[model samples]
Target: MKNNLRGKIREFLASEDGKVSVKAPLTLGVVTGGIFLAQAIIGPTSATACPCQHDWQCPNPPHICSVGTCIGG
Candidate 1:
């Protein structure tokens, strides 16, 4: 069993595709994709800023109040 494990490790280390140089890119891509997927799943509902003031308030709960008007921002 030990020899089999050692052989596998040696084969991984000696081969070009099994080496860290080749695997690092694939690992990085997988990690980056996972981060993006998590962000997409748990990201903020609105992608804009919601401004407010003391006197006036936004008509819409989440709509932004800019220049005394409500727009997407």
Candidate 2:
């Protein structure tokens, strides 16, 4: 069974149909690598401050916390 599979693999590898040109694999590898690189290099998700007390926690420094949200003082 293994030998038959091996023979078939050898036949496929020897055939021109199974042989892909260098550019296809290179382009695929480059695109795949770029996607992975982009994912890895992406920064942490920054959540916008909604409910605040101090001016720093508010979206704008001109606003102060009124009730829960920051509103213009």
Candidate 3:
């Protein structure tokens, strides 16, 4: 089992085909940018942000508050 795995690794490294993997920073940036873009495009729904004071006092319950806006159930 170990020898087979080692041979496969050596073969993979010897070949120029599979070594070109995505860069970590680029991948992370792309993912983060995608999330940010989605948020910007979709923005925040009332379900995500409800305007009010206090949890129960707020019109909606179990919602999170962002900059005085509540978001949740």
Candidate 4:
């Protein structure tokens, strides 16, 4: 029984249908990789400063903590 199952599995793997199944994951991987690479290259659109509790906690000078965010005017 095990040998029969193994033979069927081997036959499936050797078929063109198996090759088609492999392409979907490969395409998805490529697209996912491209998105990551684009993000790495382009970076975030806006700087996201850490939430601030005090004015001193803000990284930039002349910036104040208001509503948990740093604002510079």
Candidate 5:
């Protein structure tokens, strides 16, 4: 029974499906790593809304204080 199980394992390892089983995780890891690396390099994409009472309080141009929050630009 032990020998039979060993033979079955060996046969599975030699099959094309076994090759794909090994490669799939490797491919997924590489893709996931690449996405993380890209995000790290690119930095944050959105600006955080800051509390403000007037337009001038918002330092960056084109942004304006509206409803006590900085928005638009």
Candidate 6:
């Protein structure tokens, strides 16, 4: 019984064909990486001031938060 099991195991291991699938996620990865990189580069482009005092003082459109106050548009 042991010998038979060993042979079977050997045969299975030595099989010529098996399930080997290759997937291409390059496009997805590129798009995702691009979006993330863009966000990282341009996402924090707020116009607020460095040391803001009030809401109306910071930059407009994209309110940037500085050390202690909100920047204006």
lDDT of 3 at 39: 91
lDDT for each candidate structure:
0.68, 0.69, 0.66, 0.80, 0.79, 0.62
Clashing pairs in 3: 48-71, 50-70, 64-71
Candidate 3 residue lDDT tens string, 5-67: 999988876566544543455578899999999999987665425455656544455664556
How do the candidates rank by lDDT, highest first? 4, 5, 2, 1, 3, 6
Candidate 1 lDDT? 0.68
Task: Encode model 6's per-residue lDDT on 2-62: one tens digit a residue.
Answer: 9999998666555643112112355567889999999888866555435666655565657
* CA displacement after TM-score superposition, residue 43 of candidate 4 (Å): 1.4
Between candidates 4 and 6, name the one with more favorable TM-score.
4
Instruction: Tell me the TM-score of model 1.
Output: 0.39
Q: Of the candidates numbered 1 and 5, which has the greater lDDT value? A: 5
C-alpha TM-scores of all predictions: 0.39, 0.32, 0.39, 0.41, 0.41, 0.29
Question: Which regions of candidate 4 deviate over 4 angstroms?
Answer: 1-16, 47-73
Candidate 1 local lDDT, 1-73, one digit each (tens): 9999999988887788676675788889999999999988987654333455522355455556666556553
Predicted candidate 2 versus true structure: per-residue lDDT over 6-68, tens digit per residue: 999888766776567544676799999998888679843343335665665655557666767
Q: Give all candidate RMSDs, comma-separated.
A: 8.1, 8.5, 10.5, 7.5, 6.4, 10.9
Q: For model 2, name the residue pairs that clash.
A: none
Which parts of model 5 have CA positions greater than 4 angstroms off?
A: 1-14, 47-73
lDDT of 5 by residue, 43-65 (tens): 86554445678887775879888
Q: Candidate 1 vs candidate 4: which has greater lDDT? A: 4
Model 4 quality (TM-score) = 0.41
lDDT over C-alpha atoms for residue 6 of model 4 = 97
TM-score of 3: 0.39
